[model samples]
Target: MANNLQIASAAYIVMHLLTKKKQSSIKKRRWWTTQIFRSRQLYNGTSMIRDLNFHTDSGQFENFARMSQEDFEHLVSLLTPIIAKQTTHFREPIPVNERLAVTLRFLATGESYTSLQYVFKISKQCISLIVPEVCQSLIEVLKEYVKVIINTFINNSK
Candidate 1:
């Protein structure tokens, strides 16, 4: 009985030591480790802006959005005044061109706000506010254009 008790105590100590040794040898996987963090830091919102290379040989801008480069620029010019940052407390004002481009991309692609947040590097809340505001500005600016299109449709039908 005495010999068995000694063997059991020795076995328990050995198992504990072995378990501690294994734990010390095993490397921990951490998501926020410097190596993983550096890789994730490489993502920038600026890179999310879609290609606007109007001068490129492929004409990707026009083909993708069904609008000429000039028309897009004209639209941006008109909306800039209305959508430009009026006053910001702490945040930097988003550039009018960026705002217009993001709104246009959202409208053209029908992308959701969450996707746009990643693409534009802007917050979803900001995007939610921007899309409607820009659309309203567009409606206000294009009232005349809308009337022309409606009249043209009516006249063509007649």
Candidate 2:
């Protein structure tokens, strides 16, 4: 899970989109599902409510969404040229365009890998491999943008 204060601006934007998803999902969920969640809780009343692990929204929601849609579009535009160009050797370069969309769908829905296999018409293992590979590649690819933000934050504090 990402620390709220430390999330890159891009990640924060993604989290906001996630919040809207979470609310809709909760509303559509069956009553039995909510009961299961309630039973799992060890609660203290009066603002001490706690839920396990990261959901679509976490501390990021404590702040209202401040970034505008234009700003978000600008960010994605900045990231739009995401083609990887390496050719040391390859019988097959990953067809990243299709892979990225499928992985994003999985992340947004939290759908199980088995479910994805049927949707993607690939084996479960391939789906599993593509997801992590996408994650690792995104981390590396976004390092410059994310690191600049992080480093500026660190320098500002001192």
Candidate 3:
């Protein structure tokens, strides 16, 4: 009888522990959990891309991004169709222009995703995903331009 009681008690303890472990593993999902992510719009006005003032200061913009404002805008336009995302009920998607700017800034400065997170007011995880996707899109969109350039060079050589 004592052994039976001990077995029951051990089983109960095991069950209780399992239940507690399951509860702890289940995390709650919330929209915009961090203050920094929520303040992205407020920081946008003072962001590197905007504060550089593409029209008024092309030299500064070019220096910062390693590309002129026109080239930046042209790249944005070319990649927009491929990279654009739809806004959902939960939140608006990050704009294509912002994604391109982030990728270009990363390429130009070789800054880590963590450093860019604070500058762009975006999460490092999001920036990590954005950079690769934008780079692939750039390669895809620029292929035609590359082909044209190669063809022109060949014709001139001949």
Candidate 4:
């Protein structure tokens, strides 16, 4: 048992060493290590930190309700324009990659909050803040685009 555990730990350390250079240079190594440690603590024995990415607290993300794909795309379109404006105004909002990941997760699975935390590698609190803001932005700015689609749909239904 001890030998197997040692081998696994050695393998992980090797992988982490290789990946770290490609990932980011650690300026404050201690701080980054400490932060990572604390974040892992949030799992409270639930998360399994393996060789590569840790799958922590994965959960099902069934939509409480359902909607058509058109409705979903329209929602995304509605927010895209507004997101540009709002994101620009902030000195530095969440990074674009993070934003894209969040948006894609919502579109893909319509996941609940906890599943999102693990999948996106973000805190549940952060997800709480971002998802709603994006949703509102989508609704407000895509008025013309949505209107055109809605009008076309109405005509087709006739």
Top candidate on lDDT is: 3
**Best-to-worst ranking by lDDT:** 3, 1, 4, 2
Residue clash pairs of candidate 3: none
Model 4 earns a TM-score of: 0.37
lDDT of 1 by residue, 64-96 (tens): 556777787798899887888865774457666
lDDT scores in order: 0.73, 0.51, 0.85, 0.54
Please give, for residues 1-158, the per-residue lDDT of candidate 2 as tens digits.
56655678778889999998898777553452333224322331111212211133454312222333344234334434563334455223334433554466577678898876554444467678877876666676667766547877889999
**Runs off by more than 4 Å, candidate 1:** 1-51, 86-89, 148-158
On TM-score, the candidate that comes out on top is 3
TM-score head-to-head 2 vs 4, winner = 4
Q: What is the lDDT of residue 9 in candidate 1?
A: 100
RMSD of each: 13.1, 26.1, 6.5, 20.9
* Candidate 3 minimal-lDDT segment of 10 residues: 41-50
Span of 10 residues, lowest total lDDT, candidate 2: 44-53
With a 3 Å backbone cut-off (N, CA, C), the pairs that clash in candidate 4 are 78-138, 79-138
1 or 2, greater by TM-score: 1
> Each prediction's TM-score against the native?
0.57, 0.36, 0.74, 0.37
Candidate 3 wrongly placed segments (more than 4 Å): 1-20, 27-31, 45-47, 147-158
